[model samples]
Target: MSCRVGSTSSAPEGLWHWLGSIPHWIYPTALRRDGALWRQVVLWISGICLMVAVTGFWIGVLRLRWRRRYVGGAFTPYRGWMAWHHIAGLVGGMFVLTWMFSGWLSLNPGEYFAVRGPTRDMAV
Candidate 1:
């Protein structure tokens, strides 16, 4: 079976194919110039994406009206790109955060979250 590592099984064909790649690919950093610069670019972009996703999602949640609808009887009190941003933020933010975080973790800048090797007495 094909590993559904980042599958969009819920969406119908021709709709979710492109969006389905986000979680798996996250960013096209790997396809960039293969050198030290690429690593830094990935780290920076991942960190930024994670932060933006978190903050945007939080704001969207705050502005989301489940019980009392908005002016147009809509759940969101936004229109145009704002509306798309709000909706997309709520829907795709989580996935973006997940993939971005995983990408960031792989980079592990400053070695802050880096794990030390097994102890001498530790079993192989």
Candidate 2:
């Protein structure tokens, strides 16, 4: 059985495919060079994404106070809020994850995956 990491089970097919292919994509991008403007954009997007992700995650998870309907659930009037919260959190989390990695690379272009100078060839 495939490990349903994070919110994978609920993720859309297209997104799932992309996420599945991350290992293949990461290396190439990690080594590639990015321009200054691109880096700024990445940083801005990452910041926004992180904020949205955290807020949504909190909202999504906080609703867990209400358990099974038949069982003794949390005594709250707004029980249905959980579903929407989860959806919002999932969406936000996806964007946040992408933005974060890309932003890190953009911010530290030289540091991330920087290839060292060629090593001197040892005499045979």
Candidate 3:
């Protein structure tokens, strides 16, 4: 039989019931309930951090390119495309790295890993 919210029929236990009641748009496979103010704060902070890292990378690339053209001063004077390419690649790489790390931390909080054993106290 189809499931219904707040139903008392042959439904799953507390955890499963809670998981099933989540909205479909956010989580079709499982429930994703709204978080408290703290969680929202963390998310916003992570987002801002990601943005800062990306911006730094972009600026670093620009600095590197400028340094190469004026500082290196290759006698032959080759095309400047290589300088731009090298800096852009480095910045993009760093951006992706920061994004992945922050994303993982956001998905699972630190407390989740602090659990020692099955019988360990979870109230803390």
Candidate 4:
């Protein structure tokens, strides 16, 4: 008799199994094999992205405040270009912040959330 935790077949059976299979489909075997290296890379990238989002938020705030104080209306430095820049920065900054935060959390999930069972090993 054989015992299986999530599924008896090769295909994932439940939400947990589907979630576990994500890394295998997304990341390359080489990256998965060297978990330490992959983690370091993610940390560095997430850090950089966080820094960028912070700086962008600061710039946007400064620009908006300056325009409101001096110009007394919606006055962008570059007019049309600056308008688009502000819109993109405001919307895209949220996305960058969230994505980087999630990436950082993924490095050591046990710290933030409970982890069950033994860690999965890379097939390669």
Best by TM-score: 4
Q: Give the number of the best model, judged by lDDT.
A: 1
**Candidate models: Cα lDDT each:** 0.72, 0.56, 0.55, 0.64
> Model 4: C-alpha RMSD to truth?
12.2
Expressed as tens digits, the lDDT of each residue in 1-124 for candidate 4 is: 1223645555434445545654433355677689777777666766776787788777876676453544436545546777898868877887877877777776763355755556666333
Decoy 1 TM-score against native? 0.49
**Candidate with the larger lDDT of 1 and 2:** 1
Q: Clashes in candidate 3: how many?
A: 0
RMSD of each: 9.0, 12.0, 14.2, 12.2
The local distance difference test score of model 2 is 0.56
lDDT of 3 by residue, 1-124 (tens): 2445566644555446556654312333322244554455555556676667666666655555344455356422334786566556575767686665667475565557554766535645
Runs off by more than 4 Å, candidate 4: 1-32, 70-72, 109-124
Global Cα lDDT for candidate 3:
0.55
Q: Rank the candidates by lDDT, best first.
A: 1, 4, 2, 3
Candidate 1 lDDT over 1-124, as tens digits, reads 1234355554354345545664345444455547566667767777877787788779889998989998888889999998998898788887877877877888778778765878767855
Q: Which has the better TM-score: candidate 2, or candidate 4?
A: 4
Error of 3 at 34 (Å): 10
